[model samples]
Target: MTAIRTLLVANRGEIARRVFRTASAMGIRTVAVHSDPDAHAPHVLDADRAVSLGGSTPAESYLDAAKILDAARRAGADAVHPGYGFLAENAGFAAACAAAGLVFVGPSPESIAAMGRKDRAKEIARKAGVPVLPDAPVTGDDPDGWAVAGADVGFPLLVKATAGGGGKGMRLVTGPDGLAEAITGARREAAGAFGDAAVFLERHLGFARHVEVQVFGDVHGGAVHLGERECSVQRRHQKVLEESPSPAVTPELRERMGATAVALVRELGYVGAGTVEFLLDEDGDFFFLEMNTRLQVEHPVTEEVYGLDLVRMQLRVAAGEPLGLDRAPEPRGHAIEVRLYAEDPANGYLPAPGPLHHYAHPTHPGVRFEDGVAAPGEVSPFYDPMLAKVVAHAPTRAEAAAMLAGALDATEVHGPVTNRAMLAALLRDPDFLAGETRTDFLDRHPVLLAPPPPTPEVVHLGAAVAVTAARRRAADPVTSLAPPGFRLLPGSAPATARWTPIGGEPADVGYRLGAAFGDTALTVTVGGTTTELGLRDLGPDGVRVVHDGVAVPCIVRVHPDGSVWVNDPAAQSGWRPEPRLPDPELSAAAAGPVAEVPGTVAAVLVAAGDQVTAGQKLVVLEAMKMEHPATAAADGVVAAVHVEPGQYVEAHTVLVTLTTGPTA
Candidate 1:
């Protein structure tokens, strides 16, 4: 059998780190390829050696097949492991590796090319006796013609990109009126994400469970299915959470689906790790959705239950080792995995890429935190915003869910806005707890998407307490005496500080030491309310605040921008000291049309002197692989266009100026 002594990982972030862990355990040397922004990335430090790809975007770095092949050759890697995303499913890249005399740890190039096209894969599945969806025949690229074809397929249909997965280039058309626009947008997104603009229409099931079977094939043609993962909890057609041994799937159904997945892979002569996705209707009938010819992001959930390392298995199978499994192993426990992203769920799930000043994971039994970024790292806009995957395992599904929810609640992430709170809320959602999750879970439960913002008073109190704690630590006797304005003097007026919470007015905070709790207690006044809090310093950045006899652990960090960030179990707040100038320039932009998220201007629908009605679509901004249409707030004449198509814009940047029209 051929042996892989050294392996080159042709991916970035968590997936790269994942492969390196497996390679190190097997006594194999690991090499990593990184872009300029990722030079200090966690994965780069974890590798034996690293090559510089020297580009910020994926196109110039990770997706550059030539650069990757060259790096592998330079590192003298015997095999190339594409750890999902980037070039993982790229047939051309796999073929290039084979030409370079390097083993590719994935399916054959021929198999990838066959399954890459959704329309062609459906035909193959049908021929293989697998139940397939009745999709509309792909017409030309014209939107008008596609709209007509979509009518025949009926309303409530899905426009899916043929070349890629991960919710990119996929749109749901609820009616005929939106069919053309949906098709056009889908094509643009698909082309940008996958380099393929071709799309097809499929019937959208109103109520369905998104289930996929994990299958592995060896070069010797031996294949088996390792059960199913229920990925019904989704937002914007992207899976947010995945669990193994779906609560809905019975033993008989699992066998039927597993057998079909294995038979299809064997017929296609596939090898390595792959996932066969299906949609289970309300009546329990299942239909083939598509096949991913590479490792899936949710593979860890399967690994946890099956007690197998899928990545290690990939390496062994690529080295010409047979799976040697006569039958699939039964899963012993339920595992749930949640994708942690640098996104703001309250704001249309817009990506929030920024610094991660204070990042900490929960440590507990049956919990696994697989992350890519360490604290003091920046989440760049050049790649996907997913920071990590938190997985939890337990003997029962309820226990697993409860354990994951608590872990998420206790986890701390500062700097960039994240979906941690929303994820925690979803885990504790009544419908979710009842196992009634579906593809439209988020759509049905809008409240879960945007949890109520922390009250102004709560945020103000948290920030003030955090700042007070920092001052107390800095004034420790061993370091130095308390600074001016902070030193407590007998009969002296209380020390006062002015701070503002995000989106809130400035709050006046006054604090003085209280005799009841000695020097550790502070009588703090926020806004106009006064309260006594018992504080214990837990080192430099941590404090235990006793409020109403309940001890609450809080971590605080001072950001480079002079903002104090407070993270507690119940709330998180970023407080900034009142500015002297009040930033009048920024205030002027707030009166006009501004980008809601940082993104590139894809289309500018209005120009100077154009008259528009209220709610008219003005510009289309693309961010995090999704397009956001910015519209007019009132009927007005466009006075100026501040941004042009193809220009990058930041959040709150004015994109257009308008002069409101006189009311009729």
Candidate 2:
């Protein structure tokens, strides 16, 4: 067996850190390569040695095989682990690593090439006696040709990019009216993400569940399945939640699916860690989807359930070791994993990349957090906006789901909008708890996208905290020495502060401290209701509020942008102190279509004189490997197009101005 001394991870973020953790545990030195923006990333700091690849975008950095190989060479790394994304599935890079005398900790390049393309992979699975969906490759750019091809596949079909996963370069078409645009959008997104515009048409199963089996192989022709993960809960075709031991799968079905996956693995002579994904229908019949040749994002659930470290297994297999087991291990307990992204679920899951003002992880039992960014760190717009992966393992599925929900609710993440609340809500959702989860879960339950409104008690607590903080800051060094409520004038007017919750109207909070020393009683008024609460343990960090004789602990954080976030057991709310006088520029900028996120303009569909209807696409912006279209809000003539293709723009930057009605 060839032993590896130093290993280099040709990727960034949590996966890199994960590899480093495993490699370090095995007494192997680790090397990290990063782009310019990721110079001080957590992954880089976790490595024993690091090399800067230079450039920010993936094309100029992570995707550059030459730079990665050079870095490995400079670092004297004997092995390379591509921790998903970037070039993990790149066959040429894997082949190059082998040619350069470096051990590639994955399947052979031939296997990658064979399974990388979804169309070819389906054919291989079909030939191996595995069930597969009917599909046809995209031929020409002609809309009519695409229409004919799509018709053959039937209505409610998916235009999927053959080269990549993660929902990129994928579009759903419900009817003939949307077939052309879906094909165009899918091809464009595919080319941008995968460097391949090749697409295929496949029938869309409305209620099909996405399930994948974790399969591993060794050089000695040994293969095994480590159970299955149900990743049916999705948004925009991307998985949001994953769990091991699907509630819908019976023991017999699991065996059949696992055996089927193992058969494919043996057929391909696959080695290392890989996942065989399938679409499970209501009738228990399953169809093979694309196989991910690299370690999956949701592998932690499988790892937790199986009590195995897949990364360590990968390292061992790369060393030319044989599988020690003849069959798959029986899973012990249930595990659930949720992907926390810096995105706005209410706003089409748009990537919300920015500085994390306040970030606190929950230290709850049975919870595991794999984070990529730290507090006060910036979520760069150049990469995926996934902030962390939170996994919970327990004796039962219900306990695991509840534990995960509580942990997520307790996690204090502020600043840019996130899907934390939505995730927590989904975990606690009744339907979800009952395991009614399907691929259309999110589309069917739109209310979950928007978090429940903060309770009245929580609102008052936030306002009270805001007022207390303001009072502390306003007091002079000498006046601060006085007792908590020692007012110079008897019966003085109560201090007042106005706070406006995000997307809510401004509410006035009037508060007055108690008259006696050590008296934590504080009278707070929110809207038309006034309540006397005990504000004990007041500090810069947090405060405890005793309302109705029940003590409720709260964590409050103030950002430099004049926004205050208060998180309590019930909920978390952020409020921006309403300006005394609104800026005049706000009204003037309301008549244009604005970019929802910071990104580069990919296309401009309208000219200054172009007339457009409501919902007509005016411009398309791409960021975090996803495209977002800026559309018109009303029928209007475009007065000006403010952006062009290839132009970088900031969030809320106006892309097009419109002149409606008489103004036209």
Candidate 3:
């Protein structure tokens, strides 16, 4: 048996950090490889040694197998862990590692090659007696032939890229007219993402549940399955929330699926961690989707449920350890995980990459947070925008969902509008609570997109908390004695500050020191309503506002940009105090449609001096491997196109100027 001494992680972000933690716990030295953009990333700092790939994009850095191999060699790493994405599923990379005499902390190269292509994997599964949906290989450039194949599979089918997963190269087609466009888009995306343009047609189950069984195999010809996880809650065909021990699967069905997954694992001689994905229809029938050849992003749910450390298991298996388990352990509790990304759910979940000013997670029991970066960090547009994965475990599913929802509600994630609010709302959603989730969960429920506005009480409490915090910071021996708002001259009015909640209108808060309680007590008035609250305790720990003989605890922080964050038990809100004077620089915002994120200009659909209607896509911006199109807000004529394809632009950079009367 080969014991791994120095290990290298050939990936970045949360997964890298996760593997590093496990390797370190096992007394193994860890090395991290990063691109130019991730030079100062948390994972780099977490490693004992880090190698610089010296490139800004994945193609020039992480995706380049040669650079990674060199990095491992220079770091003297005997084992390399390709933590999901990047080169994780590249069969050639696995073989190269083997040829270089380094243990790849994953499945064998043969297994990876066999399951790398969706089309080929389906064939293998069908031959192994596993249920699979019929598909047709999309070859050649004949549109008519493609149409006939798509029709043969029936309407409402999927045009999917056979190379990689993660919803990158998959499109749903409703009829014949959409098939060609879907194939073209899927091929382009697949090539850009995976370097493979091969695609195929598969029957689309619009209302199916995406479930996957977590199976582990060892070198001693032993294998076991760890039940299944449900990943049906999705947006843009990507999973948003996942839970283990799927509510839709019964004990009998789970036994059948687990057996099938283990059979396939044994059939392929697969080793280490892998997931066999399936699409379960409403009629209790399941069909094989594709198999992921590495550690899944949602493995935490399984670990939490089974009381096992999957990363540790992978490490042991890579070291040629035998499967110690005779059978899968009975899951103790239900676990739920939600992916927290740096995107805007309100804006169609657009990638909003920017500086993460304040990032924090709850430390409550039964709650676990796997994060990629800390506060005062930047969410680079060069990589995936996922910030962290929050998981919760409990005895019951409802309890687990509620626990997860409450934790998210208490989390303080500032900057870059996120889907935190939406995730929290979905966890508590009625249909979600009833376990009626399917692939079209988001489509069926649109109200979960936007967060509910803060209550009046919360707003009032926020104003009080903000004032109390400011006073505490400004307090001195002399100032403490002065009544609140007591100016040098008489007849002076109390100080009034205009503050706006994150999603609410601005309100003027009048604060004074003298209150019904004592000189230290405070009274705040907003919109002709007054509340008396005394500062019980105020310091770095937090502040307590006493109102009606009840003290409400709050965490108040002032951001570098002058925005005040107030997190209490009721809600978490940011209050931006209106500047006393408007700044000249901020007033120069362009009067045109601007890029909402930093990305390369994929295409410019319109030329200068062209007439256009409202909502016409004028420019397409590609960021984080997703395309975002800038559209016209009103009917106008294009005056000038500021950017061209292949040009990189920053957020708020004007793309195209549209004039109503004439072109400039």
Per-model root-mean-square deviation over C-alphas = 3.2, 2.5, 3.5
Top-down lDDT ranking: 2, 3, 1
Model 1: CA > 4 A from native: 452-460, 469-540, 568-573, 579-583, 662-664
Q: Candidate 3 on 473-586: residue-level lDDT in tens?
A: 467665665454443344446568787765457888776654334424566788998876666555544567676767677777777777677777756666677745543432
By the TM-score metric, which is better: model 1 or model 3?
1
Provide TM-scores for the models.
Answer: 0.91, 0.94, 0.89
Q: Is candidate 1 or candidate 3 better by lDDT?
A: 3
**How much does candidate 1 score in TM-score?**
0.91
Candidate 1 lDDT by residue in tens digits, 582-644: 446556754357887777887898888888888888998877677888888888888889999
Q: What ranking of all candidate models by TM-score puts the best one first?
A: 2, 1, 3
Off by over 4 Å in 2: 453-457, 460-475, 488-498, 502-534, 579-586, 662-664
For candidate 2, write residues 146-226 as lDDT tens digits: 888888999889999999899999999999999998888888888877788999999999989999998999999999988
Quality of model 1 by C-alpha lDDT: 0.83
**RMSD to the native, candidate 1?**
3.2
> Where is the poorest 10-residue window by lDDT in model 1?
479-488
